[model samples]
Target: MNIVGQLAPLAFGLAVIGSGIGVGIIVGKTIESVARQPELQGRLSSLMFLGIALTEALCFIAIAVAFIPFPKP
Candidate 1:
């Protein structure tokens, strides 16, 4: 039971890992782009935030799954 409990969250963690990596990359690139083109910060920031929201939704789904009960044999 302990092993199963541990493994359950691992699955959710794995799901969030991809979204985390992608959000990190997206945020980094957005920062770089804004740095290079400061004049476009207003436009770029909005789109960047929108993308971040979508990416974070994946992690939120994983978090939801983490607390949900799974059927056992």
Candidate 2:
């Protein structure tokens, strides 16, 4: 197998791990802020969802890349 074939699993793993870490951080911080200032809950929730959506976009890209046909040697 060539480079793309070799790296696909690694790339997919990194994509999933990175996205999970990102989401965890986003959620943790959002909870901390909301706890401290309950009045900002609405704005914080919206921002959290935006962050999640953007992070998940990377996952979708990774999935697409995984589906690309590998050239036959």
Candidate 3:
């Protein structure tokens, strides 16, 4: 098997895992901030959603890459 064929799944998995971790951290911090300042919940929530969208985009990109054909050696 080609090297890229072997590694693509690993790369895709890592990308998704990393994205999940990033989103988790963002949500955890946003929740903590909201608890500390209820009045800022709206702003915090907006920021959190933006963060989640951006983080998830990485996983999508990784999936796209996984489907692409690897160059011939």
Candidate 4:
């Protein structure tokens, strides 16, 4: 296998790891905000979900890109 083939999986793994961290931070901050302002819980939760969806979408895109065939030099 060439460099691109070997690196694809590593790149996808990094993308997943980054997505997980992104999700964790989003939830943690959302919870902290809700704890401080109970009334804003509804809005904060919606925004949190939006952030998670966007982050996960990025992972999915990375997966798609990883599967694409790269031309040989």
- Which sequence of candidate numbers ranks them by TM-score, best first? 4, 3, 2, 1
The predicted structure with the larger lDDT, 3 or 4, is 4
Cα lDDT of all candidates, in order?
0.85, 0.91, 0.92, 0.94
TM-score of each: 0.68, 0.82, 0.87, 0.90
Candidate 2 per-residue lDDT over residues 1-73, each given as its tens digit: 3777788888889899999999999999999999999999999999999999999998879878887986686
The superposed Cα distance between candidate 2 and the true structure at residue 66, in angstroms, equals 4.2
Kindly list the per-residue Cα lDDT of model 4 for residues 1-73, writing each as its tens digit: 6787898989899999999999999999999999999999999999999999999999999888988888887
Candidates ranked by lDDT: 4, 3, 2, 1
Kindly list the per-residue Cα lDDT of model 3 for residues 1-73, writing each as its tens digit.
6877788889888998999899999999999999999999999999999999999998899888887886786
True-structure lDDT of candidate 1: 0.85
Best candidate (score: TM-score): 4
- Clashing residue pairs, backbone N/CA/C < 3 A, model 2: none
Q: Which ten-residue region of model 4 has the weakest summed lDDT? A: 1-10
Candidate 2 residue 50 Cα shift, in angstroms, is: 0.8
Q: Which residue pairs show collisions in model 1?
A: none
lDDT of 1 by residue, 1-73 (tens): 5565787778787878888898899999999999999999999999999999998898888777777776776
